[model samples]
Target: MTGTPRPRTVLLTGASGVVGRSILREPTALRLLAATHSAPAPEADGRRIRCDLTADRLGLEKEEYTALAGEVDAVIHSAGLTEWGLPAERYRPINIEGTRRVIEFARHAGATVHFMSTAFVAALAETAPVALSEGNMCRNYISSKWEAERLLRDSGIPHTVFRPTNLVGDSATGWTSKGQIVQLMSDWICRGRAPFLPAHAGIRMDFVPQDLLSKAVLRAIEQDVSEGEFWVTYGAEAMDMDASLRVLAKHAAYLGRDLTIPPVVDPDTLTAEQLAGLRPMVRNYVAVLRDVSEVTRCSGGVLPSSMPELRTRFGVPLVDDATAYLRSLEYASAHLS
Candidate 1:
């Protein structure tokens, strides 16, 4: 038999993250050089390269860089620190400096680059309604991403940047994961996390499933969109947790299960004292559930002027919000204890 075609090589930084892992499932004719600070448990494909991006030298010597440079066709910079506890200085070294290094390597290696940025970089005035477009000025995470995007655009390399909203989906089964609001509500119902539901249950939230995100990443590469940021997310009407939870409770009630689903108040209406009295855990819970945005022309929302308009866009074909809620419920029921 003839030899298998030489796989196009992709160097991905965060290969083990929820979205990064989904990307591995796609059948691409590429050999992936997976990089991480530490070793993850065994996965099906790719050669693992252990290099702490934060190290003084990035753990990559000249010879190693040259060897891999010859093999890689593209770089997908997925590794990043997502939690907010870290100091800004700590973020720059990895999120910014490490990115600089990867772009440098790509320049030498003759490979296109794909960078994973988040939607929060579009931090609008807390007082301003969420004005999320690729070019909207970001004060926090957005600053780092925007800085990196500037460097990439000037680097003269073919690149694609994706700023996705909150990601959903089971990391294991390509289904929904329990960390989502719907699952959180299901748990609050089933596990009795609270005697009452959140006050902001009616607020709209935007999310992108990991499977859809994976497809978008591959699509971006195949279509070779001009170098700029694109928002990869669903355009479905944002689901209010309070309303969706009622739907879930009804589904359970129809199944002959006994449960108490309380009426949830919209967070926008809560007084400061009411919010302050919430348990610390409950406060943390609200932070993740409360913020949401619709980031596409598909949603009839305005795209940012600075962000390059994507000629190739993948429309999300999810079921209605109710069905999406229920599918999320089924996901919650399966994974949550």
Candidate 2:
């Protein structure tokens, strides 16, 4: 009888990223081929390879590519352009075509693929579930991710998709590589520039801690799970917009910044002049807030259930929203400010 296959070597793209670094820290049996583009190779227990996700053969030399294909057992594709507000053209090559290349590489390597997607792919749904599941609508950044998912699904390779929501700082230390949208809002609020934001009591903002997401990715890899899409988000436990604002307000107060918490108002109620007065970044954020508010309102704040089985099996800790927000705020204050 055939015994179970041995633990496989994993080609982990975006190894210099927050999620990648966190994954590297996990105690796993599988070997890692840590890949980065321009970021310095991480000083971790893994083989570091400089790779460009958008390049032919991932920017590897002929021999390197051949060696990778021969030895790699799986690929965790986590690299992509995640910035919002950029044109579709800017995202297409990196987010879309880059994913295509990853899929191609995985195919050649005969490797299982673990794709990193986004929960916002569900933002385009007309009816939002209390917990978002696989198969949803898309637009803008979401659109690119959705297309990437499609490419993976059709790639004929064994793959699992992870759609994580707004990843915050680490759950314990609050360190983060990228300053996300929430950080931007916090920065604006602390500066007293954003005195108002559009929201309602029912508006839920999902913020998954970076560590939690990383652990989930590691678990998926370690378990060699290749099934349906996994929604790597807090789901119903997502903090309400008002509650999030309160947390930010508390941090602002601690920083000796005396300012009124921004009141949530309907975006349409604001005059064009008022919108124009806001910074371009904040203005774009407002537009997104408005869209999310509309979708949440229509869907009655429902989302897909959280992945309890994954958590239970992997011993992943539940994220505390209050603590996470505070940590993120602290990190942003230290770095962004």
Per-residue lDDT of candidate 2, residues 192-252 (tens digit): 7765777645668777778787787677777768766777776677778767878877888
Q: Once model 2 is optimally superposed onto the true structure by TM-score, how far is the C-alpha of residue 206 displaced, in angstroms?
A: 1.0
Model 1: how far residue 66 lies from native, Å: 1.2
**Tens-digit lDDT track of model 1 for 1-337:** 9997775678877876655666776666666677867647244365788766666445788788789888888888888766543456767977888788888888888989998887654454233344544422123455576677777878888888887766666333426422654466455655445545433322344444566566667766655554766775433355555555666677577546766765564545656787688899876555433333222211233222211233236433442445555555566566653
Could you tell me every candidate's TM-score relative to the true structure?
0.75, 0.87
For model 1, the stretches where C-alpha displacement exceeds 4 angstroms are 1-5, 39-41, 124-139, 170-186, 189-203, 223-228, 236-243, 250-269, 291-325
Q: Model 1's lDDT to the true fold?
A: 0.60
lDDT of 1 at 119: 60
Going through the candidates in the order shown, the clash numbers are 6, 9
lDDT of 1 at 146: 62
Best by lDDT: 2
